[model samples]
Every structure is written in C-alpha cells, then in structure tokens.
Target: MERTLSSDLAFENNSAAQASMPLRALSTLMLWQRRLSSRRQLARLDSRLLADAGISESQRYEELGKPFWR
Candidate 1:
C-alpha cells in the first residue's frame, strides 16, 4: 500500500508539471502576438501620422521587421 501511494504521488506531480508547460508556452505566444499586432498597427500609419508619433519611415520599417524583438 505504501508503494502504491508513492507511485500515485509521483504520477500526480508529473501530470501537474506537464499541464503547466502548455500554459507557459501559450502565454509567451500571446505576448508575441500582441507585440506583432502593435508593430503592424504602427506600420499602417501614414508618413504624416508617423511623423506626429516621432517615428520616421525607416524606423517604422525597422520596427515592423522586428515585431517580436521587444
């Protein structure tokens, strides 16, 4: 009975660890998605709007290309 209890505890610990891996990966993906979307939105602005935002066209392109760098 003691051996069975130990095995059960080990199984539960492994299961919990496995479950957490996906959640961590998913949150990382979501963060990257948000960054990429923000970069795309900023890239969509016209040169005048970009100028108002103090971002040059070259800077906008650089930001768009590295959306996930942040």
Candidate 2:
C-alpha cells in the first residue's frame, strides 16, 4: 500500500511538471520576443533619443549585439 501511494504521488508530481513545461517555454518565447523587439527599437533610436534615455552609442551597441536569450 505504501509503495502504491508513493508511486501515485510521484506520478502526480511528474504530471504537474510536464504540464508546466509548456507554460515555461511560452514565457521564455515571449520574453525573447520582447527583448528582440526592444533591441530593434533601441537600434533605431536617434542620438537625441538615446541621450534622453541616458544610453550611449557604445552601450546601445553592446545591448544590441546581445542574443535575445541574454
């Protein structure tokens, strides 16, 4: 009986973890998309806008060069 209960608990935990994987992947994808979009917009900003945002060209370049995952 104990063994059966343990197996059932393990199964439930595994199922819950599996269900969460898709949510995690979706969140990661959305995060990457937002990062990429913002980087593109930043790249398009003029010097005045960048200065207003307190970001230098070199800083912008560094941020723009980073992969979305970073």
Candidate 3:
C-alpha cells in the first residue's frame, strides 16, 4: 500500500512537470516569434529610418540577420 501511494505521488509530480513543459515551450516560441518579427520589421525600414534610430545601415543589416544575442 505504501509503495502504491509513492507511485501515485510520483505519477502526479511527473504529470505536472509534463504539463508545464509545453507551457514553457510555447512561451519560448512566442518570445522567438516576437524577436523575429521585430528583426524583420527593422530590416524592412529604409536607411533614413534606421539612421533616425541611430543604428548604422550596415549594423541594422547585421542585427536583422541575427536578432538574438544569446
């Protein structure tokens, strides 16, 4: 009976962990999507707009190609 109880507890913990994994994955995906969108939007801007942002045209191109620093 004690072994069964422990097994049930373990199962519950595992289930909760599994449920959280997908939420974490979804959040990560959303973050990446936002970053990519921002990068694309920045890339679409003309040189004048980039200059206004104080970002060099060449730098913008580099940043747009690789948005994530980490």
Assess each prediction's global lDDT (C-alpha) against the native. 0.86, 0.95, 0.83
Write the candidate numbers in order of decreasing TM-score: 2, 3, 1
Candidate 1 structure quality by residue, lDDT tens digits, 1-70? 3544578898999999999999999999999999988887997799889989999988888888774947
Tens-digit lDDT track of model 2 for 1-70: 3534578898999999999999999999999999999999999999999999999999999999999999
lDDT, model 2: 0.95
Give TM per candidate. Answer: 0.61, 0.91, 0.68
Residue 37 local lDDT, model 1:
85
Q: Which is better, 1 or 2, measured by lDDT?
A: 2
Which residue pairs in candidate 2 have backbone atoms (N, alpha carbon, C) closer than 3 angstroms, thus clashing?
none
